[model samples]
Target chain A: MGGSEHDDGRNGKTPSAVVGDVDDFWAQALVDVPRETYVLRLYVVGNSPRSRGAIRNVRKLCDEHLAGRFDLEVHDLNQEPWLARDAQIVAAPTLVRERPLPVQRIIGSLSDIERVLVGLGVSPNPAVDP
Target chain B: MDTYESKTPVGETITKSTNVLQKVPTGIKGFDEITVGGLPRGRTTLVCGSAGAGKTLFALEFLVRGATEHGEPGVFIAFEETAVELTQSVASLGFDLDGLVASKKLAIDYVHVERSEILETGDYDLNGLFVRLEYAIASVGAKRVVIDSLETLFSALGNEGILRSEFRRLFRWLKDRGVTAIITGERGDGTLTRHGIEEYVSDCVILLEQRVHERFATRYLRVVKYRGTMHGTNEYPFLIHAGGISVVPVTSLGLTHIASDERMSTGVPRLDAMLGGKGIFRGSSVLISGTPGTGKSSLAAHAVQSACRRGERCLYFAFEESQGQFVRNMRSIGVDLKPWLDQGRLQFHASRPTLFGLEMHLANIHRLVEAFDPSVVVIDPVTNFEMVATNAEVRAMLMRLVDFLKSRGITAVFTSLTAGSGALEETDVGISSLMDTWLLVQFLEGSGERNRGLYVLKSRGMSHSNQVREFHLGSHGIDLLDVYVGPAGVLTGSARQTQEAKERADAIARQQEMDRKQRDLARKRAQIEAQILALRAEFEAEEQEVMAILEQDKRRELVLGRDREQMARLRQADPNKQQNGGGAG
Candidate 1:
């Protein structure tokens, strides 16, 4: 169901071959009805542009892909700076996936939707073209 | 930035506001002396070294010493090891990191960077690291900061461009905070650090090296670059022991020690008499070098015992023998050191030279000297140090040690064992030049025995003896006997004894010959006097007989004159005439 909106205007410049692969993978994912709940936390530094962009991009990815099956939380490191050390955060605007067994982290603004999908394990497309 | 600046109190700002570059003392022994002061204040220093080069320990000592000695709080941001692991690792060095943390004097933040779990998606800044560092610093009110290896970020984040920029900002930020910071990095090929951290932190850079020479490891530290101040460029040997890192700044010890005019005895009165009739100068370095079994240790022991007898504390460093062995051996030479030991006036520190590197031995000696505060220090068999270090290195070490002891006004006696058949004047350790008094002892093999011969090779500022004396280690202690100088040259041991005995016998024979001559002269004078007496008696008898004949003749003449009585008057006249005739005859 989310396969149609996978190629948003921001990702429109991606090579069509990779887009085709992502589209096919998402299409197969719709038939499988993936029910695994996704857990994510986004760490940011105040109201910086990268922070705002990461927050927006990560929320959009979770809603468009997992929808109500995912839970997301946002933390501003400026207000709770100690959380950076506690969460082992080095760079600003980081996303940590804490659910579905082995945890994973993605650093930087989550602008590349395909890479975010592949990183979150939502899309089965192994070839992540960024 | 404004908030951080405001958080720094006005008092701190005023204290740190100075035109001249300020330094914070590191409190490491001999390190601050060479650096003149410590690291540049409120600036980042790059410490780069290979693995096991004691980089971590050096940084840790800076923090611990800052907190404990200087009352300055610090933050340790460990990137390689966790805080707990670091605590355990440095515990061996007697650094209580956890206790320091609990006392609010230190703060440890372990920044775990795992490259596998994290994926790079887009643009990001290392503000998170900054935030954590700032939090730790603010929480402890720290004035010193240690980021043990900032290079780990390159491997973890894999973004050189961003990481490099971030490092530049972090260093500047640390400076703005007015906190002295140390950033450690792994050594790289042809560079000070693997990640070129030196390029960012240009205030100061220190390189630590651990080299294995002849199977012995010695750590060296050098200041490669210092921005605003003069620094020692030589590679100083450093030692990591229970007391942490101690850098032996050998050349930095300028020859500025005061030359003392006072003298202390060398325990042997005869030896002291040989050295200007008083002894070596107080605070002077005395080198007693001799061949093996030449009573070098015994001479050193004599000095120690004499020092102890004067109620002055003495420290003995034995490299070739244990405490009991040395004390017992000295006892055989009548130098009883046990009483001094029991009285706490003497201390013995014995260890094999191979147990530690030359620098470590020097550092240990330094520590013991400081702790004991002895008036005299004896290092028996200083030549053993050659096994662990080169001749030049041993010389340098001894030079520094001599300088240190002189500065403290402590008399130092160093006994060196000369190798077989080498020049007695030239010690293999090459430290003779550093000594103020040099006593050379050698084995004189003659008359089927090896006897010890000692002479003052050099005594600075004093007229020392030039004659080599027979050094005897008897049960009554060292007695220096004048070597027998005869037609056979300098003879010692049984040869000297035989020569002395022969001279004594010759002297007796000469006395006997003089006595025999006197007796013969007395007998001849008695015989001559008897002959004179007999001749005088014979003359008297002959005179009497002649007088009797003359009387008989005179009587006959008188009878004839009486017959012619009338001629008596004429006889009286004739007597007067005869008297005049006799007078003429």
Candidate 2:
């Protein structure tokens, strides 16, 4: 896993670099190994403590396990409140895994990494499994 | 966030206003009147009901009516259905939800919670819902909010403790925002709501019930609790129709209507004569009770025609017959109602008695009376309601109807069909006490024939004739004739005619005998006068002979005196003696 590029993606500051690196990594990895990209969206209310905690925890979990194989988007419901109704977000700090065939939703701050990985259909022991 | 932290606590706010409770008018028909005003202002009212009990519609109507009628914008947060589905469902009720939303007067947020796709990881809060609600309310500046079936959240969410505390916070937040809100819940076993939502939103609670009695369903609304105001506690029957939910708060109607002294004719002149000289009083309820085929409807039709002829509008509700059939039947009695119908002065609303429950019928009558504003109304055969409702329910419904009509000063005529076995004075519906005037028509079974006899049983505030007139439904109209009361009691039908004919013949015979006696007395008087003339003639002749005899005696006496004078002169010696003797003779 490329740790620097994953850090840039988690910071959400260098989106172009993360995309370029992910493309390059995909081109090389496709020849050597087969991997599926994970699509995830995190719904939060403003910049509250819980919202920040959930965002940081989800980014750290994604970078440590599925570095170049995941795409995460943070949605602020305060800015776009109608999306909460659209996504059926009853609780704040809700994480939805939209891809991987069947959609799954988990509500809370994502403080437990094991539960987050299992909820997102990501293998905790990704190196040994793949 | 600091925004949620700075809100005032719910308990402190409620305690501050414990002396006076302000109400927000829902603008639902008859609902506000029952609640005395409406739900507590800036508070949440729990509406709980069973399945298919019109809970969503009730809440939606509250929001719609508030938005449209009270100029108050509303936010409808639906948990069970989407906005499009709700809008389409309420279209039949004449609610333009789409138009309202387009005009920015209403905002609908469909909060769909599916339990199967959700997995609870750890602690969570419902701040997302709060954000959505706040956004919707602010967008429309809504003063009224409806959360249709808040119990849906209990099914979707796993943790009860978090959901309960979050709901409490949400209710407090809504109150602090100064918006009146309604939260609907599915009824629970032995509880007001399945999830005990009532335990939080306790300012006001309304329970809606759809009871099936005798295979007919009736919706009732009861205000289970109102915090600080006096509200009607009875289960008021409500109807969901094209207009919307209308709660009939019948007991709230006060007897403060003014009585009118004006009189209107009953179309039948003789019937009018029977009911005071000028027919029934204006704004009075007249009951025409009779057995089947005894012309109860005909008598009511007469009043309707009479009202229409006076250029006053009339509404006739025929419970048993259709409009065409009723018109045709009335035409046979010479009471043509087609012209009145054509002219739009008389409106006919025909339906079966079993078409709806008693309250529905009453609500419909109220609606029609309001729309038509007719001066006269007729409910033909109110007894037909017995087939649909109990006698007490029918009576209560009729009492409300009568009170409504009386308050509006509309002359109402109700026909009641009495069973042949029951007393003629008693009606099956038992609504006669509410009537101002009662006309009883009975079948006079006599002389091997059945005759229709009509009598004024009671007419309040008027001097009416108590005579039971034998009325015939002729080609022209109803004709009231003097019933013959001979030695054989009250005679009617052919027996009356036969008695009348016999009296006429006896009168002729007695008149002829009187004429013969008069002629005989005249003949005897003439004979007595002739005999008197004969006696006067005989007396006159006899008197003349007597007078002639007396004259002869006088002349003889003169002759005798002259002879005596002559003889005395011849004797010459005693002239003086002879003169003396002649003088003596």
Candidate 2 chain B least-lDDT 10 residues = B2-11
lDDT of 2 by residue, B1-585 (tens): 624542775468867765788999987899999999998999899999999888899999999998899899999999999999999999999999999999999999999788887877777889888888988998899999999878898999899999999998888888888899999999999999998999987789999999987777889999999987899999989999999999998877868889998999998888888787899999999999989999999999999898898999999999999999999999998999999999999999999979888878898999999999999999998888888877887888888899899989999899998889767775543788999999988999898999999989889999999898998999898999899997789999899999999999999999999999999999999999999999999999999999999999999999998887787777788667665665333
Clashes of 2: 0
Q: How closely does chain A match the true chain A in each prediction, as TM-score?
A: 0.68, 0.69
Q: Give the candidate number with the greatest lDDT.
A: 2
Provide i-RMS per model in Å.
2.4, 1.5
Indicate the TM-score of model 1: 0.86
Lowest-sum lDDT 10-residue window in model 1 chain A: A1-10
Candidate 1 chain B superposition, TM-score: 0.88
Q: How accurate locally is residue B82 in candidate 1, as Cα lDDT from 0 to 100?
A: 96
What tens digits encode model 1's per-residue C-alpha lDDT throughout B261-317?
999999899998999899989999999888888898898888888888889999999
